[model samples]
Target: MQYSPDSDPSYDLKIHAGFKVVRDYSFSFDKVEISFKDMVRFIFPSTGYLIFNLFFGDDFTLRFLNYDLSEDLPHHLYITGLLSRGMLITGQQGTGGGYAMKIHPVIGYHFLRIPMYQLTDRQVRLSHIFDREGRPLRQLEANASARTLNDPGVKGFFSKYLPDKSVYLRDPVYHAVNKIISKKGIIQVKKLATECCMSERTLHRQFLLKVGLSPQSYAKIWQLHFTMELLKNNPGAKLQGIAFKAGYYDVAHLARDFREKLFVPPSQFYRDVNPMMQSYLDFPDSLQ
Candidate 1:
């Protein structure tokens, strides 16, 4: 059966995401993507499914972006599928995506069919907690190890946490195109694919497979997300400042993107946040 939650306010962005204390790897229906000029961040609930994250093209070094996963990889290190179990993401900004990983939505199920099976987590494999009745628990750490995305051995037990079509896919180009789109903020698909050394048709096929949005469409979403962060943190931020910071050549360009995606002027978003010191990543945007 096809599932559509577009009408469900619970999954909408009106409230944004508040803090979620880990129980036992919580399953989420909300797949989120946020942008900040050259920086793009994606947080998706692996929600019980058989999917993998495919990153391709280019590599970069990271600074404060490093995290304490079950293990650590260089910012430019390219690995596919599960990054690490128990991923302690701490803002990493590097380049390189020619890697992909097939992650089973199940707690610790590693596919026997992957290309890099030998390079998975060493000390701790993936596993899940369960209720007495056999339901998988959320964020349980009874027998936990340093978590990494690519758990080597254990398989997930529950089957109910799968994600929807829009949230799961198998393509390596989404990140490829995203690389350029994030840097440029917006571009035509054909032009983007051309720059990536592929036909527009191939580009579209791979992009839609992973990102679930057309090239232009994703760019709009990305720009809006980045703009939101900028405007949120800098309410008194000038249009020109936001524009230049967000990779636009002029304030007019910023205004155009704002009107197009948000249906409101950039200035309108300023009055929303109050001043406060905060852990930008750990704190929910609302605490501002």
Candidate 2:
């Protein structure tokens, strides 16, 4: 069934279905809970973030790159790394719920202590990553309820893993990432390299090592994200205007990017995809 953002009860029901913000860390992460029934969501590519998912109900399936890869996630905790392409998720009818933590990629890299490139477009069980330490996290997940999910107990559990403040301030890639975001991905790689005081080649290498995606790829993702935000905020705005604002040379360029990355033209995406599904694109205020 098609869901319309307005004048449709099913759309409202699906969009509102048990979605809640458990907590907002402002600086580093967000804790949220989601429950849904027979939902299919298309998750667009991200600028860069690691998503920690804790599932508590029926299984859901994730398909990437037009089903070239598919995985079933049962009731358990999993973490997904930065995705350079869109993903499709399907949850069958009947209620299912989960908790998610969206973390900054730099912090994710420090926590995982591995080259970020290895995790690009991948999801692994939390237990697999943490080994013995994962037991306590599982226990906490088992004990959590909607009301108590955001308690200090859980917050404290994760606090120990928070990277040092200096780590963020000292990282050149982090600064470059922020500059890319601040400009809404309008800056070119050469200009970004110059501003960051590094050669284009060095910047590209560092960005891949640190964020799992090259600077140009990351910028494109952010550019798409920026376009999505504009579409969401101004549904009545013209595509041509939106394209230029999002750094595309013309509407055709914007449409080409959307077709290549999202598998749909911008017009179809704006018309068919519910705004609620794109809510994840809203970065935390701290990031802005």
Candidate 3:
């Protein structure tokens, strides 16, 4: 399904935030395009999904825990690994647009053909991965626009890289991921290991290899992800209520996670950021 800001119930919130947003959830991977009328800064929360981002019209900077990364490539395409902590992104002033595809970590590992642990909390230029002469890179560049998700060029590029169905069926890590999602990140690691029919040590090793983060770390990120969703969807909801709904023990625990992972307090974050941008960081349920 495609969602436009105009047709969405949050249309007024998006317009007031100076954003034009489009989302397509029809495919296994979620695709989104967002345009900003002015310069903006926001905290994009940690997620289990590996993200591919294409930038146009302006450059952006990403600040992780200890270092800063910027996009300066001619094609302006980059793939972000599964983020373990929130990142602060700042876009330059003037009209700017970006397209992103959110991929499952298991599928991302198969597509990249490398140990996913090396990519944790990092971003790599797409040019380094794909030859400049390749059709995937060329098509992605040509279709990096407002209609990116629906464009034939983008779809054609992705078609060549889709993983096989057996990959999901045969991977224990993938099944664990589905269990984590279904529980909304509230389950214990020992229980998860038991349910997946693997020892805790084995589960940890496999999760790091396939998902770029350990099971505990991934669960924490997913918990924060769920909390963010609650905050975005319920603008007026109290912190205590939202925290409980997201499976936190209390509001203080939720606040601590925000400060630890996002580098900001919950109150300040909600007050300073745009709701539409917060929604953009959400991991879609369909992808699970």
Highest lDDT: which candidate? 3
For each candidate in turn, the TM-score is 0.37, 0.76, 0.73
Q: List ranges where model 1 is wrong by over 4 Å.
A: 1-170, 177-197, 273-288
Off by over 4 Å in 3: 1-25, 28-39, 58-68, 72-76, 130-154, 231-244, 282-288
For model 1, residues 164-251, the per-residue Cα lDDT tens digits are 3233233335345436435545456676787668887886655444433345554554455566678778877677888877767798
* Cα deviation of 73, candidate 2, in Å: 4.7
Q: Tell me how far the alpha carbon of residue 104 in candidate 1 is from the true structure, in angstroms, after superposition.
A: 14
Per-residue lDDT tens digits for candidate 2, residues 1-288, read 123122212321232222333233343233333333334444444545677755544443333434325453545556677777654433322344445556666667776666778778777766567667667666655564312335554455455555665776688888898788788778889988998899999999988888889988888877888897888788888998999889888999999888778767777676656443444555353221
Candidate 1 vs candidate 3, TM-score winner: 3
List pairs with backbone clashes in candidate 3. Answer: none
Q: Model 1, residue 278: displacement in angstroms?
A: 13
lDDT of 3 by residue, 66-111 (tens): 3245543323556788776565454323333445566688877776
Clash statistics: count for each candidate = 42, 0, 0
- lDDT agreement with native, every candidate: 0.36, 0.62, 0.63
| Backbone clashes in model 2, listed as residue pairs | none
Error of 3 at 172 (Å): 1.6
